[model samples]
Target: MSVWFQSTGRKMNNSSEGQLDKICESLSQAELVAMIELQLSEVDMLQSMFPDPRELVVEDPSVLCDLRDFAEGRTLLLPPHLDLIINLNVGKGRLSMSANLPHHYPAVQPNIFVRSQTLNRDAQHRLNQELLGYLKMLQQGDLCIGPAVTWLQEKGETFFDDHPEEVTKSDANTMETKVIKFARLWIYSHHIYSKVKRKDILDLSREFDLTGFCLPGKPGIICVEGLSRNTEDWWHKVRSWNWQKILCKKLEENELKAEEDISKYRRFSVFEELGSENNIRVKSGGFHVDMGDVFKYLENHESGYVFKEYFGISGRAT
Candidate 1:
């Protein structure tokens, strides 16, 4: 059916007789009108084949993010806690069709790829091959990509929403996963920063002073550096915990006991010094009785050093 509109972008007069008369006069003769009508029909068919903007659920959160990041012209940094997963390309399909079906492939989606500045000729050839393939498909109208733009717009709104509870887990859950997958990049860039202690992928979060929250069922760990070197003073300057207070009390008790031992030793040394010069000795800038000589004399010269004979517990030197 032929349709026309007014300058204001609405349907023209709805009277069928007037519309038919207009179309017939515009076409004039038979053959020319038939061709024009056939061309209009093709356009109508094209509109039906074109997709209305909609989102397909990205089953894998990690893949979903990687595709979006690529679209945004950013690098993907998956955490060590998250396994490297292969996903259907979501950003490079063309505008063509297959045997009656539009050119589309599962796991093959639209995306952008950047060329490495330092790539060798051979590497460049491989890259060119892939990029050319992307362009060629579009030229031949063989690739029909899904609506990633609308999907990202909806997700971004969900993340920044103050009332986040309204968003379902399937929608909001990926927000955190994408964070760990892309930010707190140590877990993504280096291997030594995190090590697997057991079978599960553990977040060595404490080592990096990171706070990681893993998805309920997904394999990736989302982490953020709650406290970094620049921001540490504001956080760790907090008051001590209960265990720290207990430790301080124990240290005070030990210090008092050490002081008591020194006092008792001082009293014994004073008494010995008052008795005779032979009993006097100096240690650590203070006077002390030569208790070793006195002990040997008492033992009738059986032992000269008398360290064992003069032994005392509780801060005594042997």
Candidate 2:
């Protein structure tokens, strides 16, 4: 292994920018040799772990060209905007990241950018910050850039699992222009009993940007409404579950019209959190629901009725 930390700290702590760049160029070459040797030594293990090149999206000619230039002591122009976009599947959702290697590469971390339609701006920034943090955590002389893609894939998967509402694609046009817009999915199952299963359904629903609930009973019923593609994606996952019967049908114009009539009141949750109790029921159904009657209804038929719980956050869904 390269005694990178010792040399790096000494050279960097003493040298000017021009001298440091020259020294970094030599260090980068040695690091490349070490990386190549390491790869060759562990070729079989790597091949088994990562058999498909398509999964990484780092084998493109542009990437090769940039690395070649860097190796040849050439300072390539940094594009004002993102030069390459790589799409990756992170958990149930997809993610895209644009990245460029700095000329000083192993010495200085690569410039990675995220323009996320999946996550909010703050989350996007956090992802980049965390990636940089991970790079900083690495011991010197390691294949520093090698960890970035893997780290992103793992971290992003975890983030999506936790948030569940942050999947995005590079294309936003489809979201706005697609017709046959709204869809309702009715998934029927007998096996969705445990709290774990319920939470799984809730997480999946949020991931696909669907709004619906699991009606508590022996045979479970899940109702969700969203854009057709998203609803279809949700249905596909529902079928994957060990469900007795899963049937999905598009809601007609008449049904949508009826839903539109109550659209104004739809924002009002029938169930609300007051103090200590969960799942308070609303009796009077208008834009405004009486809390006193809601509490009374919860008290009366709490055990008898199976209430469908809505776990979706309104603005978070795509």
Q: Pick the candidate with the highest lDDT.
A: 2
Model number with the top TM-score: 2
Estimate the TM-score of every prediction: 0.13, 0.34
What is the per-residue lDDT of model 2 for residues 84-193, given as tens digits with 9 covering 90 to 100? 34567777666665554433334444345443456653455467667778877776545443466678777886554353334444223354442434555445565345
10 residues in a row with least lDDT, candidate 2: 309-318
Candidate 2 residue pairs that clash: none
Give me the displacement of residue 38 in model 1, in angstroms: 28
Query: Where is the poorest 10-residue window by lDDT in model 1?
Result: 243-252
How many steric clashes between backbone atoms does each model show? 14, 0
Candidate 2 — what's its lDDT?
0.46
Question: What C-alpha lDDT do the candidate models reach, one value each?
Answer: 0.26, 0.46
